[model samples]
Every structure is written in C-alpha cells, then in structure tokens.
Target: MPTDVTYPILNAQRATELLEIAKSYDNDTAFPAAELKEIGVLLSQVIGDDKFVGSAEDVAPTADLLNAFMLLLICQEPTSPAAAQSALHIASLGALAGNPAITSRGFRLASRYYDALQDSEKAWAYAKKAAQAGDDAQLIKLQNIAEQKRAAEEALAAQQAQAAEAEETAELEPEEPEERERTGTLEEQLNELRDRLEIAKRENVKEHSEEFVDINRQVQLAAFSEEDSLPASPVGVAPNPSTALAKALSILLESAVGALWACPSFATRSHVANKSNEILRKYHLSPEYATLPAGMLARFYADAAGNNTDTTGETAADFYGLAAKEYSRSGNEARELEMLLRKVEVFLIDNDRDEAHDILASRYVNALKYTELPIAARWTVLFSETLRTEAENMFKSTQVLMDFLGRHPIASARSPLDFNALAEVFELLGDRYTSANDAVTAREKYRVAYELFNTANNQEALAALAKKA
Candidate 1:
C-alpha cells in the first residue's frame, strides 16, 4: 500500500496558473497532444509521489491540475477508461484535502463518465455528491441528461415491442413521423414535483438520508422556482411568501452557524450565535420553518455548553428540550428522541447523574411502551449503558440490564443488541458484583460475559476476562 508523504507547498503563481487551466476549459476545448502529455507527466509525478500534505490550500492546486489533465484526456479520447480513473483519483485527493470545489469537479466528471457507461444509479450518486459539495447546477444538468437517456431507452423499447403495429399504422396513415416529446411543459413539471413532494410528505419519509433522494432533489429544484409559478410548499403545508425567501433563509441560517464554527474567539461565536438566534426567532413560529430553526438553536447551545466555563449545562438542556418539543410538533419522533438523548448526554457530561438518569429513564420507558421495538431497542440499550456507567445505584443498573435481557434475549438470533456491547455490559456487571464482594454472582456473571466475548470472537476481551477469573 502506498503511504502519503508531506511535500513543500506549491508556488502561488504556479497554483493560480494550474487552477486557471482547470476551470477555464470544457470537454469541447482541445489541448495540444504535447501539452496534454506534459500535464499527464506532471500529474503522474504528484500522484506517484503520494505527497498529499494535510493542507488543502497546498494540495488544491495539484488536484486542479490532475482534474485538468482528466478533462484534456477525455476531450482527446472520450472512450478512454483512463480518463474516468483519473477523475476518480482526483476525487479521492479532494476528499483527503477537504476541498469541496475539487471534490465537486471530480464528482461531476465521474458522473458524466458513468452516465456514458449506462450506469445510471452510480452516475446519479456521483451527481448527488457533487450537489452536496455545493454544485447544484451540475446536479440539475446531470438529472436532465439522465432523464433524457431514460426517455430514449424507453422510446427504443417501445419501438421494438410495437414494430408490427407501427408498420401497419404507417401504411394506413402514410403520414410524416412526429418528433418524440422530450419533457413536459413548465406547469406540468411543477405539478409533477408538487405531487411527488406531497406523496413524500404523506408517507412521512426520512429526508435526512439517501433513502429518499427525490425529496432532497425536489427541495433543491424548488429552490430555483421562478416567482410567477412557485411550487414552494408541499401538500397541506403553509407556503412561504415565495420559494426564494425560504431558500435564502435556509442559506443564511446555515452560513451563520458555519461562521460560528469557524470563529476562534468565544465572543465572536456568541455574537454570531445571537445574530443567528434573532433570524431563527423571526421564523421559528412559522409551521413550515419551526423544526429547522429549533434544531439549529439546539446545536448552537450545545456548542456553547461544550466551550463555556460554566459546566452546569442548564442552558444547553433548555435549548435541547425546546428542540425536542419542536420535533414532536413536526411529528418527528426520531429527532425528538435524538434531542432527548442529547439532553441526557449534556447532563451526563456535567456529572449530574440523577438528572441524566431521571430524564433518560422517563423518556425511555414511555418510548419503549409506544415506539416499535426495533426503533426503541437501540435507545434503550444506550440509555441503560449510560446509567450503568454513571448512575449512583448499581442495583438499578443491574435491574435495567436484566430488564433488557428479559425483553431482548441475547441468545436469540432475532435480537438487535450487539454481542460485543452485551459482553462489555456483562463484564461491567461482573466487576460491580466483584467490588461488592458477591463471589457467587460475580463468578456467574463472569462466566456469562466470557461466553458472550467468545461468541463475539473478541479474543482480547476473552483473554482479559480469563485473566481476571
């Protein structure tokens, strides 16, 4: 395996020239064969050396140069597999450097290469990555390209399937063949998007993950809606004044939080946070926007709690509680539970064991009673383990453990609990009993823990437990 090594930063003049070359040209623009080979050699030397220093500013120019070489290679030989591989390598470099611009450019090329290979899903995934790296325009272009490709493929399939019928109809009519319609008109497209968004909202789809990429795509597309026919709101949801205002607000809130993260001085962060809070407060009452601002405020307060000298965590708990309530109002039980867990974590960090225990236990019992086992089980395990480590009453910890075991038997294959984690829990229980000088219970727990460790194929843990025994 090749290891990365640090190199001296590139010269500023050379870096600028490389970026200019990379960004100025498109696939149609050709490079001289000699110039392409020269760039290829330069790229090979940089990559072959594997000297991608941690500084993105230093490595960015090189990444741009590599991507430029890829573009030139593609321009010259569109069929070359090497061009695709080169773009992929540049993307990896971009990830290592944490350069979004470079990553987006690399992903754009990779998307195009995969699209040309008829790998629609892979192409779409790359395009999605590009969009996330702040290249929304590229995502739209790629979507249109993929849609056109799908339409063409369907047209071809229809022609093949109806060849006989088409021949008979052609002989009967003897008319000119009409051009295939590419896409719907503006109004029809808006209606289609609105319908899809309504369906997604009705289904209560999880928008955070890629499980429903179309939701994100539709949201992003809606951001670009023209004023006259703004399909801004989903079905049964209150609309913003316009789609632009909603998009702008989202951007401003995100930018404000981002600036807070980058600010070194606590005073500056507080200033930014206060300003962000003002913006959030203005729209927080709006049903359409309430959930987001509440979550953002929770994040802000959580950060402040971590950095602030006061360790009480009182302020953070209040914000997280508000976030939980907002999530509940939005009917997002998962996020609400997550915020509750965050509250528990904040209290735990402050060493307020009683507060953490009460909050977590109260919520966990209620959730387990109402929520699905698969959903609640993980949270239950987390809460129990947290209490086991931090709670004052060891017996209560043991009871929670026994409760978990009774509900989700470890021996069962259908159980969602992790075997290694269960082994660790048992090991901790054995230690607690040993500390209490209960030889019989300690030995029994140790045996159970040893078995679980062995079952999990955890050789190190088994050795440690055997040594203790």
Candidate 2:
C-alpha cells in the first residue's frame, strides 16, 4: 500500500554512511551501542512496515541490508533470541531479493543466536546456508564457536549430574572423612579451572569473529552491471502497440536480470536467470517482434550474460558470443568489443587461463587495434590485475603495470581512471619491488600509492600502507 513518497529515503550515499557507522563498532573499543540500536529500531520499522513481499522493490533491498546490520548491532549477545528471529526474517527477505551478502549475514547471525541457545543442529544448518550463500569464511568460524559452546555446555551438565549423584550416594553411604578431605579441594579447583578455560576460549572465538563482512560496495557494483555498454533507452525504432505485452515483459526481464546478478549466490539463483532468458528468447522469436532492433536483442543478451552463473562460464560465454555477433550485425563495433572483453573476464573468473589468454591474444588483439584508449586501457588493467593477484606472477604483473603506466600516465587518466584502482596498482607495484628486495624503488612506489590514496580520500587504504610509505 506504500507509495514511493511514503517509503523511507535510503539512497546510496546515506546507505554508505550507515555502513561506515556499522563497521566502526569494535568489541574492544567503546562505542554508542544504545544509540545505534535506537537507529536500528527505526530502520526495522521501515523494513517490516509491510510484509517485505509487498514493499517497494528498490528501497526494500537497501533497507533489508541495513536492517541486517542493525540487528547484528543489537544482538551482539546470544541471549537476544528475539533479535535473532528478526535476523532470520531479514535473511528470508535477502533470499527473496536474491542478495547473497545479506542472506549470508542473516543466516550467520541466526547461527550465532542458536549456538548461544545451545541448539547445535540449527546453528550448523544456518552456518551451512551462510557458506552456500557465499560467506565461506563464516562457516569455519561458526563451526569452531559451536564446538566450543557445546563442549562447555556438556561439561557443565556432567558436573551437575555428578554432583547430584554424589549427593544421593552420600545420603545412602557417606564417604570416609580422610578420603573426602583428600579429594574435595582438588576436585573443586579442577572444576573451577575448567570453567575458566571454557570462558576464555569462548571469548577468543568472539574476538576473531567479524560483526559483518563489508559488501556494500560490491552490491552497488552488481546492481549497475553492464549499464555503461548499452544505450540509455531502446535504440532504432520503438515497438508498436501490437507488441506491447512483449515489450513490457522485456522491461520486466531486464529488472529481474539486474536483481539476480546482484546476488552473491547468483549460481544458486541461476534458475531465475534461466527463466528470464527463456522469456526473452520467446519474445525474440515471436513474429510480432520480427522488426525488433538487433541492438535491443544484443542489450538483452549482454544483460542476461551478467546474470548467468554457470561454474565454467560456458553458458555466460555463449551469451556474450551471441551479444557480440548481434552488436557486429548492428554495426556497433564498440559494443562488440565490450562483449568480447566481457567474455575474457568471464573466463578469467572461471580460471580458464588458457582460454582467456587465447581470446586476449587472438580476437581481443584484433579488436583492440580499432578501439578507443579508454576501452583498451580497461582490458590492460584487467589483464594486469589478474596476473598480479590471481596468477601470482609478480614479475610479469609489474612489467605489465609499468608498461600500462608508461603508455597511460596517471595525469592523462585523471578524468577516466578510478583513483582507488590506480592507487591499488601502485600499491601492488610497491609490493612487487618489496618482494624483490629493492627497498628504495619499493618506497617510491608506496609513496605514489599513498599520495593517490590521499587524493582519493580513501582513509582505510591509506592507513593500511602508511607504514610502508
């Protein structure tokens, strides 16, 4: 029933500020816990204002994300069963919205909650779900925590049972004074030490566990995938009224594609992506849409490619191939090259290095010869980063990076390049030099990286490498 005006305004900038506030909380540091909880309650009102199923689609995803964080803030302790239940509800919303990060957090929070309640089975199940949804690190952490909790609980229960048995046996047949005196004090001390050890172990687990993995920026990236490659609206001729239903369906498909691609568990959500592709294919094959622009079909294939989640990237590669052919047919050479680059990226993600390298060496080289500087620069950066991080060939990585810098100076790229990305490249260059024992050159690279991070006002990255600089 809520109108757009009635919905709470949680835009991207506001969302970023909220995420920073959540990340600032440290168990070791003093923070405004009560104030944050108060904010959470208000946000919860917005998230639960309607059955999330009926909430405004765009606002709901962000609101649910914030609500998950807020719930974590309030439910820091295991005793807050109610808050934990709320987290499960928020997680269900994540499933509905197809957001893996939010879903993973929600399930992990519930796992902690159930673990606190000594429900190991439920905790384990939720933890597994969290892992399946892309928070792979949480699964191991939760398992360790759960094992510790269960052991402590079992020890306490055994201690109580033994005490009761001893009391009953004493009523029937008392122990000798000398025997009791010899064992009583030592037994009590051992029990006390065991209790202290369990408490300390639990504390250690809590200390290592992060409140939430930072994923706000990742969600933003997924939400806007492929936005740059396509035209703002449909190109060529507009659809006639006779094809109105198919056009409406196509619009719906595009929205669904974006939502599904934003999910970190896009692989599990592939069924939805598959169905959307089927619907688009139906429209494309219809005689009523025989006049549909190849550019429009290309856009559909390109967007669909982003949502594809096959493990080997074969299906996604095919979609990109189809999109490239369509773009070529439409005479959009830039878009065709974009699709080819995307195909390379897909292979890179799948770690099909040979395939990715072949494409880069073959089709990409020929395509790059005719592309603009910015497009060519993007491919170079991608290849260099993959070599540095994924392949772990620091020498080759450095060579490629230096060559890129030589050709595309930072000054020339100030308008087009992402400062954080450029700063990271410099940071990696510093790391490469540091590994080679060239301290002087390394320091030079770090200094440039530091300056770039400063210019970008990226305080966290700056702090991380400040000592190196």
> Against the true structure, what is each candidate's TM-score?
0.35, 0.37
C-alpha RMSD of each candidate structure in angstroms: 26.8, 35.7
TM value for model 1: 0.35
- What lDDT tens digits, residue by residue, belong to model 2 across residues 123-240? 8788888878866445556544545666689667965765665455445442111211123332343343334334433454334211101111121122222441111234345655
Candidate 2 wrong stretches, greater than 4 Å: 1-273, 279-291, 306-321, 363-375, 385-397, 458-469
Task: Estimate candidate 2's alpha-carbon lDDT, on a 0 to 1 scale.
Answer: 0.58
Give me the displacement of residue 447 in model 2, in angstroms.
Answer: 2.3
Give the Cα error of residue 378 in candidate 2, in Å. Answer: 4.2
Q: Any idea how many clashes model 2 has?
A: 0
Which pairs, if any, clash in model 1? none
What's the distance in Å from true for residue 142, model 1?
63
CA displacement after TM-score superposition, residue 226 of candidate 2 (Å): 32
